[model samples]
Target: MNQAIDAIRTFNRFFTRHVGAIDARFLDTDANLPEARLLFEIARLGPVLANVLQAELGLDRGYLSRMIARFEERGWVARDRLDSDARARPIRLTQAGQAAFEEIDGRQRDAVAHDLESLSATERDDLVQALTRARLLLDRQAPDAFTIRDARVGEVSQVAARQSVLYAESHSWGHGLEVVEAETTAAFLRNSDAERERCWVADLGGVMAGAVFLTDEGEGTARLRLLHVEPFARRRGIGDALVAGCLDFAREKGYRQVVLWTHTVLEAARRIYARNGFECIDTQVHHTFGEPVQGETWRVLL
Candidate 1:
């Protein structure tokens, strides 16, 4: 643990130095790093409440107030009292502040691009992947880091292809699972009812981290299908969120119960089902996916 902590600290020091974070002026801007960031946030979320910025940035209230006052004095920001609540005020960036933010943003981008230009293409790719993994690990702990929304156009095929690749590699399911996924996903898209059936994708910072679908099974029953989380994105409560989303949709649609089928080897998914009140109602030996395995049917009352 000590070694790990030391390693992380070393990396932090190196990274801060690499990015010129120790300098008072960030990217040759008049404002320091924190001040520049505050300006950027104001530009991005203008008409946003000051307390909202304080909570979002984890800044001390007095410190943020002072910073805002400074910006106001510079004629870069303006704050207006809320009509409904006089105590609450919303902050906005003036034209001068927007220009400042744009300059900082452009310089930051150029700095990053120049640094990346020093590395080979392969090294740059590795750096991006490493950064993605780091972000996924760090952001997983935040409750609002992942969001569940309806799948967009062409996303169904993406989900099916991802599931096919993951299952084939991890479970030795071969091409049969891929064929099934394509067929099932295509059918769902072709005949889906917007009000009664739904497909949800869990996005983490614009990446599709997980997905699940609740389809009408007729007879007042809903079928929960294709609950999948990317291998790197597991153990992040995404599976739980997807399951909860399915169940909530089922309840909203007035379904009497939900059912799902899964193989015995999918222990993580099975655990999620069990925790969500699904009971394994039946098990049978099956060779559906190029292997002899125990198939289980689970059900939950809505």
Candidate 2:
């Protein structure tokens, strides 16, 4: 553990120096790294609460307040009282702030591009993969780092393929399961109602770590399907987040109940479903996926 700690500290020091993080002016801008980061955060998360920002950045409350005061003095940001909570004020970037953030972002991008230009394409790819793995390992220790969002175009197919591959490797399932996944995904895409059907991908950092889908099952019922978490991303609350997001979306769409089907052998998924208030409604042995397996249907009333 001590050796690991020393190694991490060494890397932190090297990375800070390599990125010119110790420089007073970041990307040749008037704002330092912290200030520039604050501006970027403000731009990314519009109208963010100051307290939230302070907590996220791990800045002292007074230091953050002073920084905001400086931004306000420079006409770069504004704070407005929340109507729902008058005592709480949210900070937002001004026109000048947005322009400044853009400049800083462009410069930072250029700097990164310049640094990567020295590496071959394959080397760059390896670097990216290594970084992704590092982030996944680190983020697994930080529960709040995971985010659930709508899956982007072309990602649904990828999710389906990943699920098929993972299941085949983990459970000795054959191509039948893959065929079923493909057909279901295709049908969902072809016949889904945008207002009723939704799919969410859990992202750890920039990687798609898990996915879940909710589709209309008629009679005000929503079916949860294609739920999966990558092997490297398990035990980090990602499955729970995906399931919860599905149930929340179902509730919002006026679903009277949400249902799911899973194999009894998938104990982790079963635990997730049960923890989310789903009750086992039925179980039957089936030789549908190349083997005799007990398929269980679970439901939760919203």
Candidate 3:
């Protein structure tokens, strides 16, 4: 209890000192924190809709409207309607707002620098290590779990749509480039209850960004299909996590061999597969999107 109390006190002191307490002089009352933060957010992600800000920031609509009005009055922001839908307005920072945001951002960084300078290098490293350990513990203690239900009902449509776009763009294929139909994918998800096939979706913050599926071809062989991570979720280790989940499930189902088919052009996927014990076992030359391409087959022993 005493140790915990000490830690809490340390955290409070750190927060107060670094994040500006009532008596803090670094950030004067030139503007309220909310307005300053709003300015920064607008400058960082301008041309973003007000609805998006409200959702992302959990701000009340009335409050957001008031802030936006203030920004507009100051000539710091401009609102424009979408070309396709004039009713939908997006807010963007004007030149004046951008300049103000840069000034505020510089000040914020300087404040952080001041706080960091007060700590010795070893102390800073120690603080970082502690924070990292705490973060990992929190993540493991409450792993962000997505509903592991049958994907075919409605969610598979989402996976198919995004996956189709990814493949179309990367392969330069136009129109009707979706490799798998929704009906087929839905059937696969629906039939996977017995582990004869499986599709797993990793919902990060309520969005399906990572997925891996398995299809049993019978005769002791299983195929890993549709292993993909959405572009926004890349580099977050979601892809690896999804693959690991799929492999664990496949192994538990007594699969002897697992195979995956992917284009050789996708170096990131290939690297991930290789790191996860998949070896390229076959390759075929084919024409896709008016260009010659090589498709590689990778296999792993369960």
Candidate 4:
């Protein structure tokens, strides 16, 4: 523990001193850190909605409004109304602001890269690899950002049809996947919501890619069921996102833990759950789904 604490402190000191983040530039000028950060964000994601910036940065509406006003006074930014929403406004960096931001951006990157280059090539590669691994691990452990929204009417039928087709092809288990008609799924979806059972469908580019549901498990716990990502979206991290979203919703609804039951044949899902801190607590032989399969129960404390 002492070694770990020391390593973290050393890294923090190194980052602050050598990273040349926007905060450092604030000191060089008389400007403050918040303003500098706002400028940088605008330069990077300008033509972005104001509300998006507020959520992403966790800035107060009043503070952001004042900052934008300041930028506008200096002709450093411009605001335009969103076409889809008349009341919504998006900000963009003006020509002068873009040029100024570009110069600062180059300096910031160069400073960080130069410090990193102080290390040997082999050392740099190893450090990058370690950081990448740490990020992947952190993402698995962290709370998911996806929110639980109301599923549109009849969304379950679409998801079930998608899931049935997938299971039929992927698992040798049985025609059971083909046997469970859409009516069963439609009933489940219609009865579930944010309060009782959480159900969600992932929509990208205005199309539903996947869906998952967590029904009441009794005793302050919930069971994650019906995790299905469409074939086209299977490898795109959608499954992990769905699982994380379900767990997050479970926590929000005052659950103490979340559990899942799945066949051992689904190695990918198992790994995702395990990485997110789920542990197998039970197993059994099941003849359901028309296949003799070994089912495992996994759980994670909220």
The numbered model that scores best in TM-score is 1
Model 4 ranges off by over 4 Å: 1-149, 178-187
The local distance difference test score of model 2 is 0.88
Off by over 4 Å in 1: 1-106, 109-134, 137-144
Model 4, 132-240: lDDT tens digits are 4455444444332333355677676767777777787787534565555465576575565557686788764334667887888689989887787655445567788
TM-score of each prediction: 0.60, 0.60, 0.50, 0.49
Tens digits of per-residue lDDT for model 3, 1-302: 99998988998898766676544233763456778878877877878999988886789999999989988898889998888999988899889888878877888888878877999987886676565445544455434444433453466667777777877777765444464445547777567555467777866544465677788877778888887886655667777777777678778888898898888888998888888889999999866445677889999998
Ten-residue stretch with the least lDDT total in model 4: 139-148
Assess each prediction's global lDDT (C-alpha) against the native.
Answer: 0.88, 0.88, 0.74, 0.74
- What are the runs in model 2 whose C-alpha is more than 4 Å off? 1-111, 115-130, 134-144
Error of 2 at 71 (Å): 35
CA displacement after TM-score superposition, residue 106 of candidate 2 (Å): 14
How does candidate 2 fare on TM-score? Answer: 0.60
Model 1: number of backbone collisions: 0
Q: After superposition, how far is residue 99 of candidate 4 from its true place, in Å?
A: 29
Clashing residue pairs, backbone N/CA/C < 3 A, model 3: none
Tens-place lDDT per residue, model 2, 213-296, is 999999999999999998778888889999999988888888999988998999999999999999999999998787799999
- Clashes counted in candidate 2 amount to 0
Model 1 error, position 80 (Å): 31
- After the best TM-score superposition of candidate 4, give how far the Cα of residue 124 lies from its true spot, in angstroms: 52
